[model samples]
Target: MGDASRPRFMGAALAGEAGSSRPSLESGHHSYPSFDNNSSVYALNPEHGGTESRTGSQYFNYRDDPNDVPMQPLGDSRYLDEKRATYAAPRQRSRAKMILAGVAAGVIALIIIVVVAVYFGVVKKNDNDKSTNNDSASKPSGTSGSGGKGSSSNLVVTGGDGSKVTTDNGTTFTYQNSFGGYWYWDPNDPFNNGAKAQSWTPALNETFNWGVDKIYGVNLGGWLVTEPFIVPSLYEKYPKAVDEWTLSEAMAADTANGGLSQLEDHYKTFITEEDFAQIAGAGLNFVRIPLPYWAIETRGDEPYLAKVCWTYFLKAIRWARKYGIRINLDLHSLPGSQNEWNHSGRMNDVNFLNGPMGIANAQRSLDYIRIIAEFISQDQYKDVVVMFGITNEPEEAIFGLDNLQRYYLQAYNNVRLASGIGEGKGPMISYHDAFLPLTQWAGFMSGADRIMLDDHPYICFGGQSAAPISSYATTPCKTWGANMNTSMSAFGMTAAGEFSNAVTDCGKWLNGVGLGARYDGTFAGSTAVGDCDTWTNWPAWDDTMKSGIKQFALASMDALQNWFFWTWKIGNSTETGKVESPAWSYQLGLQNGWMPTDPRQAAGVCGNTAPWDPPLAPSATGGSGAGQIPASVSNSLHWPPTTISNVGGGATDLPTYTPTGAVPTLSAETFSSASGTGTINAGNGWANSKDTAGAMVAIATCSYLDPWVGQGIAPPSPLCSGGARRRDVPLPLITPPPSPS
Candidate 1:
């Protein structure tokens, strides 16, 4: 009976009272359906956590043979033809509070009323300030590496394949920025007084009816950026850690650093399955996981980090499945300095796909995908997960388009031919942008059916064009985190990878939206620029955007795209507003992009208008196969909800658009006949049955969508024709993945 409210950071504090159904560590992410026949592919991430990070190449849990799909642990090997339903990660927990059980059978009904009141009171307190606060634009005055000051003692993390840690008892543990690893920071003002930690709740959003095709779909990063380690037993019981033991720093920190642990505390936890489950029930679908290649390939024959980290990963996956959420596997860092940092786990040059390490990494990525596909693809979740992304955000200089294309294409082929794919195989691919020219996307790689193009959009390059809510449907080009219209061809998710209101708005403009990329395409430095002569304040609603949320909601629903806001949360950064402008980018996320719950904030995004109730999200797809894109055509990927939908009616349901928290949910449709003009999926994004014929072109990347579709809460028109225009340059007549390869 808890009243609904606005979106928030991991509702870690919501764990006090919860449901009784104890979820399996694996079941914490998503509950899978029954599957008997299959081979290899151990469908769980825990086994990998145990093997990838602890054991070595020869240490997987599963075995060869498709028949082993259902029982396979996590290892390298193949299997033959086999059939099964599918598998999904279980639901992880959240931070929301729970209702007390049976106050009194006689007063049970009355207790329900009291529970509702209490829920609102707690939620209101958290949301009130959040709902209506900000006035002037405020710059971030952060805490710097001063946080990393040397402590009186050192904490050693051992056991569970180094999954164990020894804290200085309760001594002052200091973690400098260097401890976490080097990343980009403005030099002049390179220190602050604010570090951030997160309260991770497993994804429980209702996103079954849709998914992603282009990399623009919503996804959060930094998973492997830094690891947090704390009370293991608590996390061991976390519903999110279902089968595998994935590691995250956000869940293991204290409140001082905004609940963040020093970088050295790395991957430990004290969470419960109940905590993760609440998260799943709350509605945050999809967890963009960034794992270091070392967890599974460091010593090849002796992968040391897996036993623990990989195991955690499995636990997370299962919980996500139980909650019916999707997972986006991202190799955030590479063997060598993929982007000049320690995030990839080391600060060296690791040629992921073109060197000895490349082979190792490729095999690591491939084998991982193979295991997952073989094990879970046949189960009930076969159609839910989209693809296994090759790497996170890599520079074209290191991971060149041609080379990347070659490497990924090779990987894709391996996946297709590996077996256990049955008649329906999702896809395996990779993504990169900001470094390559947007105009040159067509010139990149293409071969796999799930060839997804990713780009990072930041506003550092230009001026901020102000427009009204209605203007969002047409004006404000599609470039990442700048002013935009929902219907414009330039505002799609895939067209403009990630966005952050981080630098630009501080907690200012982004009480809602995010930021990103450039004009000619290719990576440039951060898009941090000077702000207009406007006053900004604390983390309250930006005057313009607060009311604008409704407008933003309308546009995203119209398009249906998914996106990972720039960040989920950020650690303490001594350097604040240090960007030199015209080349700055703010990290998206309050701590990572979730904020505190406030009464007022909750009122606007929650209550009756909110869609977090049970049956909140229903299946929207209806087996007409998937939609299609023009054959042998290379479409120029860009931003804007309307633009993508118009150009390609392909996975129009793909979550290529951005996430708008307060919109109404959609339903699905079952097609009895393929002979109608336009179909109405009774609910969700299903192919409107009762259709006779109206063109069913198949988009090569079958997994992607219109970009807008995934972001929409309600059903949308595949074509919003708000601003259709002529192409300025020639587009690639790109071809789809080779049949079956």
Candidate 2:
């Protein structure tokens, strides 16, 4: 909508050299020679011995004396003999002196020639050596310049400490840290934007050892994926717009007000490079970006803008690289709503896994996952986007565990197939606990690839209580700490994906549009305890309240150990002119003295709680057992399970899309500086080109009920049903290559 004709850079296979590896010093005690600056030997220009000068006048000066004797007169007769003797002596002396002078001149000429010859010989040898090195360094690796796994040889170190690197374009940026951290980017490679989330985090080129490195993170919520509570101004403009779906519809209807095209302005302005810089400045290392599936591509009937958000998503990645932050790319919404929440693009029905089109919806989801995996699994991106959250919060209660796990297994298999199975091969597949207890998923897919368990623990949604805010300071530690520790040992790597300082859900639109907060009982089925003014009006909050909130935040950080606070910020509501959800905003808290300036301050807040210290399993760290899910387990959770609860007949009876060969890959926005722009190959959006599976498309002769709202509808025909054939079974287990020594 906004200058669609603008040159949007797409990835291509280009030639580029791999980056040079840093030189490592051997470990040992060593001593260096000390120099004295005042010593003459070290002086830039030292005094040399003076050379003696010889003149013909000094060798033969005879008659210049004033006091000459007169005896020369008596030598008329004897003088003839004296004169002959004198002349003979002078001639012999002159001849000997001339011989000595000629010999000295010849010796000096010989010395000069030998010195010049030796100096040039050494210089030529050194030049030859340098030429050889440059030739090897400049040779391009057989990989795409963008998003390829290869490093760029064109990288030249421009900083004293080797932190600054400049590519062929002359664009220079710093990477590597005092800790063993570094960034890996070849402007030629989009998948390899060299970034290290923190000084302690690994660069895109390095392996990320989960459970070993902690995650001090915040979620970039309501940015790419819009939320009513997070960005209320957008909704306030259209009173009838309750969620993104309706908001899009309302905006589309009003052509005079810039219409739906106005969304491009929001995407560009909502979050900028400054926000990413501030996040890093606040000492946060990782960010969880919740993205909608529409960012990739949308169908003809869908009202949401298609592929516009993808441009912004690419911008987000580049920004993260600039600020040294890692990304957790979360797929928040799917074809049908994964959860019946407004954040999932709609708020009406749980059609993703609990409706007549559930199987069909899931099939679309798998295809999307596969597409994304192929893109991220590219060598360039694997380092920065370390983790991939396949889904946000699916309502497991509505869709049985078996139905959900089947989808999870298929999604995992698809991702592994695209990216391969290993720690650095692709992003760690993250799964949300679906609001279920952690114990319920303790040993899920025990031997499968790198899987991380994500849980969102919040006390705010439990309704208001008479308890004071100060009393909840230690609540997180008491409740979630031990459980998370156990989950790590029992389930594998576990993280509290979302948590906040709010003890009461009192923010505007926190529940939903027009639905008031539960704190004042405006929400259905809740009793009022106190007025909303106290919680919503953050400006009036006293020091005591701020202290309590700070303590609560610290406790949550300590409890979760590895977590991303619900959000980095809460946008100002157009109607309220302030952030109603103050507690949820990490940026707001930090500015007002509620959130910690440095997240590390939360380390010991829980008091002597021995943190989870168990050694990670081989598979957990992308070692030997990676992607080794047992055949029995994989078969049990096969794609398109034989039956589903909501479908009137077998799951195969559900309508599904055919796999056409049309795939949409994400492209990046290129920047031009005084130096030339660096090119990044975004790739073909397919990770495994060997995988020639077609794109998921609507069947030509079939009709589908509204995928979002169609529930309990019987299949119109058997041909409408579609699913994986026996040939679509899970691929064989692949053992990843050993880690570098």
Candidate 3:
């Protein structure tokens, strides 16, 4: 029997030889033909000069010997004996030769089959790469008026038209750009700023004239920066966990479920390239990304995952760049909570510019701001990241307005130093309203570079009322529109950073985890307005409900001419398995037919209410007077204010960090193309290497208080105080300019 381990073809060939005729050996001299002759062994017919046309059946015809010699009858005993004697020896040799030939033929056949498969596989791969390149070439880099060089021809389009692209870490996602937008990357020149976000928006290479170009934007909330209302599952897992700070602690103790590393999974999965593409397809141009300070680095036993989100942040930038979406990078949470809110990393203490450790926290915040400014100012990112929100919703009531302004001035100056003093040199510095009136900041910084005031106007959180949704449709038009229009002319460039559709606080965990909503009277001291089921149940919403929400959304769009919707998406509750706060999500609104298909349709929603037309100031449009600040104004708003509100004595009495000369600079994140041999290497995150100042570090001799929990405590000793500039120099109070008559 043939060896079972041998090739199947060899076994089959050997089996065919079983009953075949055998060559006979004549007396004394062996007459068996030699198998070594190639023509005699393999030729179909040696009679016709080793070439003959044979039928299918004739091809398998076999003869024991090449000569076609006949076998003698077995009746002759002498002849039979002679035949048996010679046949035994010659037959054994012939059988061995046939086995070797069959094995050789089987090997050659396998080689041919393997060669064919490999050749076709390589050809198919090349064809796919070529097709991808062709698809990329079909996309337009910019609009007709955009006078910029288009993207490089060699760039292979890995994404566009909902095509799938795998990231370097093997994370696969569909790039959902149905709009006439494309991702532009030229490896030869990484800083080529010539890609458009959409056909309606200006190309990255062109100037974005604020007020002239409408910002149809959406906020990427609850991503990078964790929020209980947005992602309930993360908080619901641990019953005791209230916010990210507590969540991190709880998750750390439970190592069975990946421990603190689970956050990295959330970072990877929560929002992806597809989301950015969807935003673009929805006719949105700008994305406001709320990032936490821990994304840069964590300090002093902080339980947060440090620098992990930075990888995703970089990915966000690339995805935004690909989809032609501009970014307004907002520093959502600071070292200590910016506001004593859960979204600010911690829930209770307003240590940032508020308590005993306020000054120290602000110092660390400034260093981070400077570090970020240096990174974004680089040519690689300046075009994409146009606005930098220095802070997100600081409680001005708790942290005095004067202290906040001083900090803002310091941050502004540091950013200017890191970047240069000129238009387009860096991002426009954005400051939140700090929950204060926009009018209060009318002329706060009259002539101090390119600055913008951001306000978050939301009717949902302003106590509950059982009013019909249609009744509130015109509220935004009458109130928000007028306020924003007035502020634009008064404050140069003002934008509603966040606004949502929900007229009442109704969603699960909308207030916070375990903290119920005011709509159903679950919140403390809040009166019940109506049943929350109607608001939270999106599937049950009727046409009338959708119409009211749509009108309200349109009015809001018109009101906040330059605005970013509160959030682009809202995650579903693990318990419910559906989006509880459907009204707040711009994505859900679009999917449900509540949001306008084209945002421009909202332009004249409020009849006769024209949008604010900005004045022709060089500084406003990043022109000649872009970063020019009046000397008087510059001198008045000095860093390290004369005194902090809660801290005793002067600013010198506040706890602070000493510069350790160890700046943690953010490096670039890179990606390889899925279809071709191309790579996008975002340059080292630092824009200006010369502006390197030592990072802030706690002094060893000083006893520092906990920034998060130790609010309202006495300031540390004098040894703990430093990093303040000219403590003896007392600056004049900042008097706000009168509102427009």
Where does model 2 exceed 4 Å of error? 1-197, 422-424, 669-680, 717-741
List model 1 lDDT by residue over 298-345, tens digit each.
332321243244444555444344333456666564543243223443
Per-residue lDDT tens digits of candidate 3, residues 158-178?
Answer: 334555655546577665555
TM-score leader: 3
Task: State how far residue 65 of model 2 sits from its true place (Å).
Answer: 99
Per-candidate RMSD, Å: 27.5, 29.1, 34.1
> Largest lDDT belongs to which candidate?
3
By TM-score, rank the candidates, best first. 3, 2, 1
**10 residues in a row with least lDDT, candidate 3:** 6-15
Q: Candidate 1 vs. truth: CA RMSD?
A: 27.5
C-alpha lDDT of all candidate models, in order: 0.28, 0.65, 0.66
Residue pair clashes in candidate 3: 197-324, 374-687, 661-694
Per-residue CA lDDT of model 2 for 1-741, tens digit only, reads 111111000000010111111000100111111111111111121222211111321111000111111222211221011122232322333576678877777689767764454334322222343234321112222324332234333332111123555533455544423332333333443333334444555443345568877788899888888888899998899997777888899999999998888788888888876677567667688899998999877775778987888878878777776556788999998887876667888765667876777777888888888877877776545656778999988766557788889999989988898888754367888999865557778889988778999987765654365456787776666557777877898999999888887776678877677766556887654578888788878999999989988988987887788999989989998766899889899999989999988676777776633567757787787788688888888888877767765667676566666665366655545432212344433444555767666666666566677777546667665453254332123232332221111
